[model samples]
Target: MTRHETFARPTIADKDFVLATDLDGTFLGGTEESRRKFYSWIEESRDRVGLIFVTGRDPGHVRDLTRRRGVPRPDYVVGDVGTTIAEVDDEHFLAPIAPLEAEIAAAWNDAGMRVQAALRSVPGLTLQSSGFRFRVSYDMDPDRFDDRAFDIVAELGLDALVSADRYFDVLPKGVSKGPSLLRLLTHLGVDNRKVLVAGDTLNDLSMLTMGLPAVAVGNSEPALISALEGMEHVHRAREEGVGGIAEAILHHKLLQ
Candidate 1:
């Protein structure tokens, strides 16, 4: 099956609304050919879609790419794993959210106090001061970091998500792509049911949970495809990188 065959477009015309997606490995490709496809998707869908970027990257990097390349700026951006929301106008401006680093730090230290702490924990698994913190398992066997790190974060009450190949991001308990996307939906007065989200990692899972409709690109982990398997509304694109993203949108008839 080709990438476009992954998701069947609904016959019913839904509201014209949101297209929220991730950046790395979704829109922008790691190589030149894929990058062009990313740009093509924007050009093809710009007028019909309310383009929003929900990414783990900082808002500045998002803006920098837009400014440097002259690509269409996202209407709304949920960045730093939902720690910052930006409303882009003539310029990209940031709206800050509550910082959760201190709380995560406190939790780690308290876990250390327990007599039977399951694993060796980092003192303050602080990735940066950028609202949320990412903690990697220090005791992880070199070959098993992904599974181990995921296990650690799963124990937390906060919104913990894994991404790329090596890290897990910790967000405020309620903040995630779904909630962040809905916030943009509310701002635009668009119906949530019309939204379509696409991505390739664990961080993308929340938006899928929104139960609107979601597309997991071909490069996405096998576990994700299995999780979404029985859901008719959830689709998996066949192409990798940006080409896959276009297939997802077109296959879902999001551009129309």
Candidate 2:
């Protein structure tokens, strides 16, 4: 798992490529060597491969990673668990996803404060301060989670994604990583076929199911692997973290 193997170099004939990946166990889960190799490839292929971060993290959290962990700065970020999207520049300022925000926000039936008040009494649900215009997150004790809480979300026309057995995220009913990523792709005019998605958990399920080439890292949650079972153009990598991602890139012949 610690091997630092590099894949074939990008060819001149290679078409434009975009990599949309979840952080946590997917991007940051690999061995140091594998991560370094992946980062080197990204830095070297900057012109041919566009890097995007499709994460549940907020903008500030994402910024911290790039600043402290040497994570490559992303061209765009779909953060707040896909409720927010922004274009990032070299200087690290984020330009809000204009024109699309209105559409995405229409799904929020009530103010975040209102939703918070409604769910406050739900046992085992602790609000996470990392929230944005259309998303609210909470840590839940799965054993204590009550269907009534979800009922409240449904009544309010919101959707909930519970992942890793603990995170309870509430967002607009129709918004998720997949649709948000696709929206960003359309805005950038990137062909779907030229994209490769990577993830390792249930929250990442939407992006993996998008039918673009995908990589499920070896350490992916069982739920994710089960959900992705029999899917085409999806590679279940043997290596964990970026090593798995590297394997998928080679398998798909994206860099040769």
Query: TM-score for all predictions?
Result: 0.69, 0.91
lDDT of candidate 2 over 94-194, digit per residue (tens): 67787766777777755588789889999989998664778889999988888798899888888889888889998898898988988888887787787
Q: How does model 2 fare in lDDT? A: 0.85
> Residue 92 in model 1: shift from native, Å?
3.6
Find the candidate with the highest lDDT and give its number.
Answer: 2
How accurate locally is residue 58 in candidate 2, as Cα lDDT from 0 to 100?
Answer: 86
Candidate 1 lDDT trough over 10 residues, lowest sum: 133-142
C-alpha lDDT of residue 111 in model 2: 57
RMSD of 1: 9.9
- What TM-score would candidate 2 get against the native? 0.91
